[model samples]
Target: MGESDPFIQRVQDVMNAPPLMVEEKESIQHTAEKMVDQQASSIVVVNEKQRLHGIITEKDLVQRVIAADKKTGTAADIMSASPYTISRRAYYYEAMSSFLMNGIKHLPVVNEDSTSQVVGMITLSDLLKKQNRGKFDVLREIEASSSESLADVKFAIYEVLGHLIDDGIPILHIMKVVTNLYDRLIRHCTELALEEVKEEIGSPPCDFAFFLMGSGGRHEQFMMTDQDHFLVYEEPAKEEDRQTNDAYFKKLGEQIVYWLETAGYKRCDGNMMASAPGWRGTIDHWEDRIRTWGLRATNENILLGQNFLAFRWIYGSEKVRDQFVRGVSRQLGKSKIFLRRAAELEKNVPVPVLDHPIRALFRVKKEGMDIKKQALFPFHHSLQILSAEHGILGETPEEMIEHLKEKRVLDEPFADELLYAYEVVLHIRVTQSWDRYKLEEENSSEVSFRQMKSRDKEALIQALKAIRSLQTKAVATFGMA
Candidate 1:
C-alpha cells in the first residue's frame, strides 16, 4: 500500500513524534512558552517519572490562565487530567472514530507497550489533511446536524456503510462503528428534545435514564432501525411530587419520539417507544412491571419481558440504570418457571427453509425467506434465556455467547460452531439489508434464495441447522422436552 492509503495506515505514520512534554509541576506560563516555541497546539503533561499525567492545550492557557487570571497555576492545575489517548499501532480509522465519537480535537498518543508513556499526538486537522474528507464527511455532518439536517445525515450514513463493506472490514466491526454513529445521532436527538422540553416545562423533577431496546440495545443494528427505547426516572417522595414528575417525563418522552422520527427513525410498530405509558415509568414502576411479567409469563408478557432483557442504557444517570438492571436481574434469578416457559416457547419455533433440502428451493418461493425471523431469532431467544438464568448481561449475541462459554454452559467446540454460524448469518443479513435499503425496500431481513450465491446459500443452510441444534439443546437442558 502507498503512503496515501488511509485504510492501511497506522496512527504512528501520521502522529507528531517526540511530542512536546512538560512536567506536571511546570508553570502555566512555561507550558505556554513551550507550546509557542514548538509551534504546537497542545503539550503533554507528564509526572516526574515521565508517564502521561494530563494534557494542556492552547485553549487551556487562554481560558484557564489568561481569562481566569490564574497566572500562578501549575500545568497540573490547568491541564485536562486523564485525557483520551490512542495506541501508536491502531489503524487510522480508529483514531478518526475516537475524534468523531468523543468530539475531541487533540488526541494524545501513548506507547503501545507501556500505555502510560507518552509517544506522540494526532490532531483532527492532521486526519482531515491525510485522508479523504469524503469518507469522514458523514461523521462531521452528524456532529453538526440540526433537526432538519439529520435526515440528510441518514443518507450519508448509508454511503459510509457501503464504503466500509467495499473496504472488506469485518461485519461485526462495521456494525460496532455504525452503531456508534447511530448512538451519537440518538444522543443528539435526545439533547434537542430535552432543550424543547425544558423550555416548555421547567427542569426535570429528578434524575432519569433513557435506554434502547431490541436491535439498538444489542448494538446489532445495521440499517432501517426503529425506535425501541424506554425511560426510567427516580421515584418521588410525595404524591404531588410523583404527579409532577410523571407529567414532566410524559412530555419529555413524547418530544424525544417526535425528534427521533424527524431524524428519519420510524416509530416502533409494537409501541415499544418511550412515549408509551408501558415503556416509560418511575424506577419503582419498572420494577413492579418486571415482577408482574415474571409472575404472569403469558405469551404477551413473556415477549415483552424477553425484549426488556436486552435493555441497554444510552443516556442519563448510570446509577438509576444500574438500579433498574440489578432489580430485573434479581427478579429473573428467582423466576425459574418463567425462564423455562421462555425456552419452551423458543422450542416450538422452526427453521422452515432449512427443514427441506437445498435442491427443494421451491419452498423459499420468489419472495424469499425472512432470515432474521427464521434463522437469527432462535439463536437469540435461546441465548437470552440462558444468559438471564446465569445472571449474565451483554449488549450483543457474541458477547453473551462468550459469557456462556466462560461459565461452562457451552463447551469450546460448540461455542466456536455457534459463533461461526452467527457470523455467517449476520453478515448475509446485514449486507442484504443494505442492498434492499439502497433499493428503497421496506423489509431488510428477507433473503431471496435464487439471488444468493451457491456457497452462501449452503453456508446459510448449515448455519440454520446449527441454530436448530442449539434450539433442541436448549429445550433438553431446560427439561422442556
Candidate 2:
C-alpha cells in the first residue's frame, strides 16, 4: 500500500481501456447491443473525431429508452451530455473522490494530452475490485446509511485510517481521503436532519447555508473531530418572516447537531455550532457581527472571528455562502486593527522549545508536548492572520500559503519552507494521534519526545523553528514588530 502500490497508482494503470463506445448517430438499439456484446455496464458516446461526446449507461438505457417506451432513437438523443470524466494521469484516490462527490459509478478516462480523447473507462466496481474491501466498504456503508447505523460508520473510519497508515500512504493523501468520508457522513446527517425538519415543519422558509469552521473547515481532521459549524439563512423581507425563518433553522440546526453527534463528532466546547444562536443568523446579522469583531478587537472577539474566518460551506445555497464570504473578506480588508491585534496575540503565544535528547537525558522524566498547540497552531495562526489581512479567503493553511506566494506577499522560497515545515508538523501530529487512538487512549494531541525516533525529533525541532520564524514575520508584516 506504499507509493508503488496499485491502490495509489495512476488511473491509466488500472482503467479498462479500448472502452466500449458507440458513435453519436448510432441507433439506440445498436448501443444496447454493443453494451450486451461487450458485457459493459456503460458505453462512451463519441463524435466523428473519436472524441468523447457523452456517455450511455444501463440506467440511462432503462430510464431514457426502455421506461420511456421509445421505439427508436439515436445514441445522441438519449445520451447524458457532458458527463463527468477523469484524466488517465489521475491517481486512484482522485477517481474515488470524483465518484464519491458526484455520486457517479462510471468515469470515462481521457488522455492527458488530448483531454477529450477517451483513453479508458473506470467504474466504482473497478476501484472496488482493485483495492482492499475495508478501504471502500466505508464509502458504500456511508452512502447506504439512513439511520443511527451511521454511528457505526464513524468507527469504520479509524479502521480505514489504520489500513492507510500501514500501507505507508502519505499523511496528506490520507487526510483528503478521510476528509471526503467525513464530508459524506456530515452531508448524510444533514440530509436526514433536513428530512426530519421537513416532516416536523414544512419546507424551509428561506435559502440558507450550513458551513464548517476550524480544522473541519480546512479539511485537516485526521482522527476524531468536534463540531464547529454555523448556519446563515437569507434575510427575510418582513420581521415576522425573519422570526419564522429563525425558528425553522433553529430546529434544523439542533437536529443536525444531534445526527452528527450520533455519528461520533463531539460538540464543540466553545459552542461554535449551528445549534447555537450566535452561530446561526441572517446575512445582515453575520455581516454586522463580522464588523463588530473588527471594530471591537477584544481578545474573545478576535478568537471568535478567527474561528469563523476559517469557515467552509458544507451544504445549502452557494449563493448565500458566497455572499457571506464576500462580506467577511470585505470586512477583514478594512480591519487593520483587528489583524494587528490578532498578530500580536499570536506572537505572544510561546512555541514549545524541543530540547535535544542529550540535554534531556539527565531529567527525571521525559517531557511530552502538544504538537498541535506548539507547532501546527503557530503555522496555521500566522497564515490565518496574513490571509485575513490580505483578503485571501483560502480555507486551509496550505491554500493560504500558496495564495500569499501568488500575491507576492510571501517570497517563493519562504513560502515553500513554511509549507514543508507545516507538512512535517502535521504528519507527526496525525501519526501520534493515530497511535494513541490504537491504544484506546483518550484523544490527545500530546507527543512524547523521548518516544519519537531521532529523525522525527530532529524534524519536529526544525519545524518549530520555521513556525517561530513565520510568527516573527507575521508580526512585522502587520507592523506589530
Report the C-alpha displacement of residue 257, candidate 2, in angstroms.
0.8
> Given candidate 2, what's the lDDT at residue 397?
76
Question: Lowest-scoring 10 consecutive residues by lDDT in candidate 1?
Answer: 1-10
C-alpha lDDT of residue 313 in model 1: 88
Cα lDDT of model 2 overall? 0.83
Which lDDT value does model 1 have at 199?
92
Candidate 1 runs further than 4 Å off? 1-20, 27-40, 48-52, 58-73, 82-104, 109-120, 352-368, 442-444
**Candidate 1 overall lDDT versus native:** 0.83
Best by TM-score: 2
lDDT of 2 at 217: 81
lDDT of each: 0.83, 0.83
